[model samples]
Structure formats: structure tokens, C-alpha cells
Target: MQIVIAEDSVLLRAGLTGLLADAGHDVVAAVGDADALIEVVERHRPDLCVTDVRMPPTHTDDGLRAARQIRERWPEVGILVLSQYVEERYATELLATDTTGLGYLLKDRIADVADFVAAVDRVGSGGTALDPEVVSQLLARSRRRDPLERLSPREREVLGLMAEGRTNTAIARQLVVSDGAVEKHISNIFTKLDLPPTDGDHRRVLAVLRWLEGLEP
Candidate 1:
């Protein structure tokens, strides 16, 4: 796949370029700031654009703002946005649209290189990727409805891991359970929480994000 990148950190930008190039994806252009990012993206029209949520001159939501613009002007262009933390406001904004080809994740998730690339691929193919922590915080803050209150202790544990964005295999590893059992727990959590029956990972994440959105102010 062809790609464009927008990130302010020099080390991370270089590392990401190397990672993507190693995966046989072409890096059409990479820029240091949001404005430069926009210019390169429009020039190259790559398969996907991965950007950081914060960039100069304000060090605020420049990347997200750029992403929203891309969604507006080039709706078909895939976008993956990374942030340093699980921000409810940011998550809420990103989830407000039901558009495909979008992802919002914590920057540290890049350490899991395979998952990171998978996210890029997912978004490029029109999907969503969100940090698990974002889901957890959202779930945590939902004090009123308490849809999750009925879960058993084990189910609650499984729900927490899912919110952390763990795959069944990874969650099984963490919980010391078989993959099959992890799958069962996830299903139970979904039933208990009334989550959508989307089998896709990112879509399931969006379902989780929707539930969490209710808790945000």
C-alpha cells in the first residue's frame, strides 16, 4: 500500500517509515507538521495517511483537525490518528462519525508493530482502530446506566482486557486461558453489555466506544 505520514517527533517518524517500508508499503511522503502533512498528502494521494493528534504551532489537535478535513475533502482517503493518551474528548469526537477508513490509537501501541500495521491496513481498507484504554476509561466513567454491572468477576476481567484492545490470543495469554475460553468470555461480555454483533475487531471497538461515549461530559 502507498502511504503518507504526519508526525512531529523525528525519532518516531523515522521509525514508522522504516516499519512501513519493511512491510513493503511505499512511503510516498512524510512531514513534520500538520500543514506540511496536508500538502504532502494532497500531492501524493496515498492509500493511507497516519498522523499524530498533536502538532505545531499549537501542539493541540492539529493532526485531528487535519484528519477531519481529509475526511471532509477526501472522504475515501484512509486515516489513522495516534495520541499519547486516552482522551475522552478526542475519542468522542473521533467516534462521532460513522465513517469507515478511520482509526484513533495511543502512540505507545506502535510498540506492538504487527498490531500497528494491522491497524493501518484495517483503516486503509475502511475500518476503525481505537486504544483499549480509551474504551476502559469510557466504561469506567459510565456510572449511571451500569450496563456492565451484571457481569461476573471473570467476565468483568475479560471486558477490561477487551477495552484495553487485546486480541483474543493476547487476552488469553494475559489471563492464562485458552483462546476458545477468551472468545467465550468476550461473547458473554458483549451479550451482557448489549454490544453490537459486529465480528470485525475495529467495529467491535466502535461498539465499545459508543457505550463509553455516554459517560463523557
Candidate 2:
């Protein structure tokens, strides 16, 4: 697979470039900043993009912003983000789309080269991957909805996907349920959250986003 890398750290950038090239994958561009990253990506449109969460010129989430831009213009290109911290906000934003070709992993995991490469391959092949640490922290810090505490395990599964911007049809596909069943669960979710019934999709999404934001550290 052809890949483009965006990492401000010279050592890590060199290592990643060497490893991918040695594995017989084309390393089309290895850039050091998010602007350069975007320029190369827009120019080459490689098979996948691997970037650090923090990158140069301000060094504060430039890569994440670039990733969001890519989701807008080249939604099909796979994205894998490496981060030093387990920011649920970052993971949440990264996986906002229903598409599976997105991944977020902690940077320390790069030491396990084989596993890191496998994750890259997974994202490239259209699969979602999140660091186990990210999953645990996200679930732990979210609002303690005691009413959600009353949900059946299946209902809780549905709620998580809803928080991830999934449609009822997509949720049904994920849970292998009928659309009717998914709608029933969504109604239950609204009632439990005390959200008034709404006709627009944006209202429900806003409610969920606010709920998620309130749980942030």
C-alpha cells in the first residue's frame, strides 16, 4: 500500500518511513508538519495517511484538524492518528463518520512495530481500530447516566454507536437488528436522557454531543 506520514519528530518519522519501505509498501511522502502533510495528501492522494495528533506550527492538534479536513474532501482515504495521550475527544472526533477506515492509537504502541503495522493495514483495508486504553478511558469518564445504568447490555451497545454519529440504519447493521428495533431503542434512549422528541436529526445529535462533552475531564 502507498502511505504518507506526517510526524514532527524526526526519529519517529525516519523509523516509520524505513519500516514501511522495508515492508515493500511505497512511502510516497514523509512530511514534518500538518500544512506540508495536507499539501502532499492533496497532491498525491496516497492509500492512507498516518499522522501525529500534535504537529508543528503551534503544535496543538494541527494533525487532527487536517484529518477532519481530509474527511471532508477525501473521505475515502484511510486515516490513522498516533497520539501521546488518550484524549477521548480526539478519538471521538476521529471516528465521527460512519466509515470504518479510521484509527486512533497511542504513540507508545509504535514500539510494537508488528502490531502498529497491522493497525495501519487494517485502516487501509477499511477497518476501525482504537487503542484499548482509549476505549477504557472513554467509557470510564463518560457521564454516569444511572438511567443508562438501567439499560440492557444491548441497549447500551446501541447508545455507544449513537454517540459515535451512527444512523439508526447503521446501528441496525452493526447490531444485526431490524430497523424497527433500532428505532425503538432510540426512542427509549431519548426518554431516558429526558430529551424531548424532535423531528430533526441535528437535535438528537446535539443532545448526544452535549451529553458527551459534559463528561470531559
TM-score of each: 0.64, 0.68
- Which pairs of residues have clashing backbones in candidate 2? none
* lDDT score, candidate 1, position 13: 94
What is the Cα root-mean-square deviation between model 2 and the actual structure? 12.0
Worst 10 residues of 2 by lDDT: 141-150
Whose TM-score is greatest here? Answer: 2
TM-score of 2: 0.68
Residue-level lDDT tens digits of model 1 in 154-197:
98777667777888899899999999998887777777767656
Q: What lDDT does each candidate get?
A: 0.83, 0.84
TM-score, cand. 1 vs. native: 0.64
RMSD (Cα, Å) for all candidates, in order, is 15.9, 12.0
Each candidate's number of clashing pairs is: 1, 0
